[model samples]
Target: MAKIEPANGLKSAESRKSLRGTTESLALTDGEGNPFGSDSELNAYTSERQTDKYGFIGGAQQYSEHSAENIPPEVLRQREAKWLDMLNNWDKWMAKRHKKMKLRCQKGIPPSLRGRVWLYLSGGKVKREQHKGKFEELDSQAGDPKWVDVIERDLHRQFPFHEMFVARGGHGQQDLYRVLKAYTLHRPEEGYCQAQAPIAAVLLMHMPAEDAFWGLVQICEKYLPGYYSAGLEAIQLDGEILFALLKRVSPLAHRHLKKHKMDPILYMTEWFMCAFSRTLPWVSVLRVWDMFLCEGVKIIFRVGLVLLKCMLGSQDKLKTCQGQYETMELLKTIDTRYMQEGFLVREILELPVSERDIEKEHLASVRRWKETRGELHCKSLPRMHGAKAIMAAEPPSRQDLRQNPTIIVESPLATKSNGEDKERKKTKEEKNGKKNSSPTPVAAYLEPSEPSPLLKDTALLGSNQSLSSTEHDTYL
Candidate 1:
């Protein structure tokens, strides 16, 4: 296990010992922990570590491990030092150096900093502070029998090979239950899904259960709304969007897949649902996640596109795959040995897709799905409430899309790109013999009506906000 350390400095040996003792006390055993539900079927996996080769955990493909051991310690320290400086003055850094941070995330977040960095990226800390003691409260109550029963069966199936979850009723499995169950209570409308278990497991590996719960919230709500709900409307819409984009970017691969009657959901659901955790090699999964959290779901599409290109776009490779079975196998079984970090990440970055592109395509894809289903209401519209619900009611018009800075469709005004705007402004300023003015301040959202307790914890800290109204409105 990674040694736990405070941001300020290392803890004393006594403190470390105390932490270990508490952790051991919390570790679950067959007779030691509370059962999730009345179903005795789950008892089979909880009695001992499951090594079933046919089960979900057993069926999962393992890949070579990647670690910081490959990099120089001194180089890591230098980067960590720079990141630490930014983290120390996070509010200032977020306000002034967001672009720099996004660039850094694209490169990779250091393993040591990933836990905290992910919390920040997903606004987990803010949500955690807001919901102090909520996890414990929800966890203390018995979960709904139906949800608990479903969650119990899948507990041992997640990351069964990992040290954290290998043992029956281990800390990892226990925490995963709390997080997933708390979410069921938190958003009863969505209830639970099997895909959510792996996603929550990934978060728990990074932070405490409470922090992980909120991080999961940001992912399901802010990052991937409508994805874990009934009917999986958003994911189906995304599959169509992926197929459409595939046709535009890799028509040869698209045509081949189409000819075989392959649907995007056939291969892309797990990719989208688990964020590629169960698909990619461990190292590549981490690297992909670093960019995914930074850029949003667009990275998922970009990576999926790259995989399709490799599998079907190349004639030589396509010739080996005779039919849908071979094609599907090749799609799921990615070989990361050839996916060198330097090359694969570069290719993902170089891909022509952007968040704007994905959003625009998503709008059309949802419309297509809704029309086909003939629903009176746009059932594909994400579930929102209060102010957000009001925003979603407004249909996105050409005028609205044109005014938004990020929705980069074929607008004549958008012909002058952001880069062009900067260059043009710079030239004008220089010609007039005036210093270039500071860029316009982004309108910060989520301004609380009262003083947040978070402000009291750190005087320098400011209210963390969502994307600008224009950007947020587009998502709704």
Candidate 2:
């Protein structure tokens, strides 16, 4: 302003200063581009730097808009329900398939399912309660003297050689003792039998003590008739039945055995008697029990068939001298869990008759056999008594071996010397023809010498000689 001398740059020094102040003021603009009155004043306004024209927030906004326009809540609910139903139906289908497979398949039960399956099929649940109550009731009544003694005797003998269960104070032995004792108290009639130990041991695989006790009761009552009978008649009948089945399933092996005069009874008795304890692994035995509960007694036959079938293929490998040994070896070697489902199904599907019919026949046959034995007993009663009375009434004779005091030689050396002296005396007597006794020669007195060349040459000559040789040609 001092005449604002239209200075060189169109403004004087004062004008330039004013212009810079104006530009500075313009830099501090509000929303409407207005400058503040004071430089020290605080600004409280917010600025919108940049924004979309639509309410959408760029890429996210487009997706949000598309979803809001297209999706329905009811459709989502329907889809969720559809998937849930599919899962539920699939579970049901799987359950049914598993149950059927359990029944008809021959493979061993899955380890996870074994305990529950055994409990269900073996009537463990029902029998446990049944026997618990019944056993307590029977315990109050006096049991037969013979049965109590028998039970007591067998308690010590049960699983005598099984070291796993034989550790003095272990759980296995304790459980066994408890079950056997409980069963004895419960079933006064059957008491404790030798076979019960193996059966109990088997039951203990999948069950607690009380359940195993009841399972043993069920096995004794339903599956094995006459198993605990005094004379063991049922064991014989079962043997016969098992042999018959073996014959049907393996005729060639049967013929070979028959030709060799071998008895299946020799080895299979333990299998039939103990329910595969001696013949199968404990796990495999448990598997057999799994099928046994559902299929009844016939499972034994089927299992025996499978064993015999397995053995049939391998019979040629066995030496003829090992007939009984081979039969036992075969039983011991057979996989009890082989095609287990198929085996169970085949047996259940094709039993000789209804179980009820078999039960009836078995019982009737047992009764008849008992009656026949009773008749034989009655016929022989007088002779048995006469023999006993004759022995009792006769005066004590010199031949009364029991009355004669046994000479006890304290030392083994003395006993041996006495035996040698007696043998030498007997030999002298025999030479003198005092009696026609063949005395045992003194082994130590006999001198050792080289094997005779004459004997070796005679053996060789005998081998070389033809059957047509002269009658007088003695090789030695």
Candidate 3:
């Protein structure tokens, strides 16, 4: 098959001339994606050099730590301490104490530990170990003529203000190029997509090329499969699912979307495909990523829904949006307050966007797509993650879910030890001076009056009504 041209706008004439090959391997004093801090060295060639505390150049040096991130040194130490323990016993946490691990992720991974935890959470560490020497081998190769030029062309465009990619050809761009090229070599069929550049660039900021390569692998293959594909059928499917979910989650927003014929892809593609790296502030990007790695794509859905609700929920808020283009503009440029790491993460979890809901929506969307647009155009449905996304069963069923979907999100604080509950009960008994031999369980399993429509050929989220719209994808 003839390979596709560069998705990012790059001069075709220059693209024919090969960019620098990966003959020179990168060797750094530091290892791993976890940049304990910013990894930028002032670009010697550029006079416009000013690095923010969060690490972007040419902008006033700034600090916009998430609310959760801005804590007393003591509190930071406490979080670090807990994370250290969790890191030490990661396997146990993944299997036994996963809820605790998830709760911790929702709070935020310490910036220092972010890279390491991401490697662990995304199973990137395991992938690297399993495929040892693979990335380095691919990195050292000349790379495919098809993707190499285009990859090189887009390198400077990614995170241009960030010190990493500021220079025309620096370690950041070089590493980003190598990672993208290697992926082209690794998955030659999917080839290169422009969106992968920013995603790869984001990974390169924290980890080395090889580690970043594997992390990108997990994202494309596991977290959001086929998102960066040549056709981007997967992201398109998700857009449909997101829109369908919106109907239940936010009727007004859904109606406004339907009224203006706003496609989910118009708003959701960049947000979900880039994983909100483009739309959100850097700190919030990392915060969202922290949960994304831990809990899988549900975080993205919750975030999209939250944004949709905020954007068009109220009659007054709806008044501001007059048309599709205006709505698209609003979505593309999210409000700064909504992008706060502390605020966004809390609000994301506060809304209930469970895996089951996503799956049911996925099945319904797929059925509709098959009916309307035909099969996903040479694509099989992407695999959805189980409760343990890092290591999961294929297409996890409703039976595999830990809890049923509910409106209110259960706070991690509410997840207390039975010993604490027992202690409270004992105190109450002492005060009453009489103890019932047995106390009723706070939560009783109530059998549903009717069986589920799990396998029914109908719109499950609705009363067997077929979903109408097919959402549209391939975000940059």
- Could you say which candidate leads in TM-score? 3
Tens digit of per-residue lDDT, candidate 2, span 141-222: 4556655555444443333323323233446556676677667666544556656776886566455555566667657665
lDDT at residue 309 of model 1 (Cα atoms): 82
Where model 3 places Cα greater than 4 Å from the true spot, the runs are 1-49, 58-62, 65-69, 380-387, 393-476
Clashes by residue pair, model 1: none
How well does candidate 3 match the true structure in TM-score terms? 0.72
Every model's TM-score: 0.67, 0.47, 0.72
- Cα lDDT tens digits, model 1, 1-476, are 12213221113342223222212333332453332222363445445545331122322333333421255767766666676565555555555777787788887877666766677666565566556688889889887888889898768656654544655576778888989999999987678876787789887776667767888987888777777776565666788889989988789899888888887766777678788776665666778888888667888888899888867887888897888778877775566543546656887898999767787887797677667765423143443321112223432223321211222223233344545777788899899998876873232222122111221122111112112211111111
Clashing pairs in 3: 33-206, 33-207
Q: Native-vs-model 3 lDDT?
A: 0.65
Query: C-alpha displacement of 162 in model 2, angstroms?
Result: 7.7
Model 2: CA > 4 A from native:
1-113, 130-164, 312-315, 322-476
Would you list the C-alpha lDDT of every candidate in the order shown?
Answer: 0.62, 0.45, 0.65
**Highest-lDDT candidate:** 3
Clashes of each: 0, 8, 2
Error of 3 at 336 (Å): 1.6
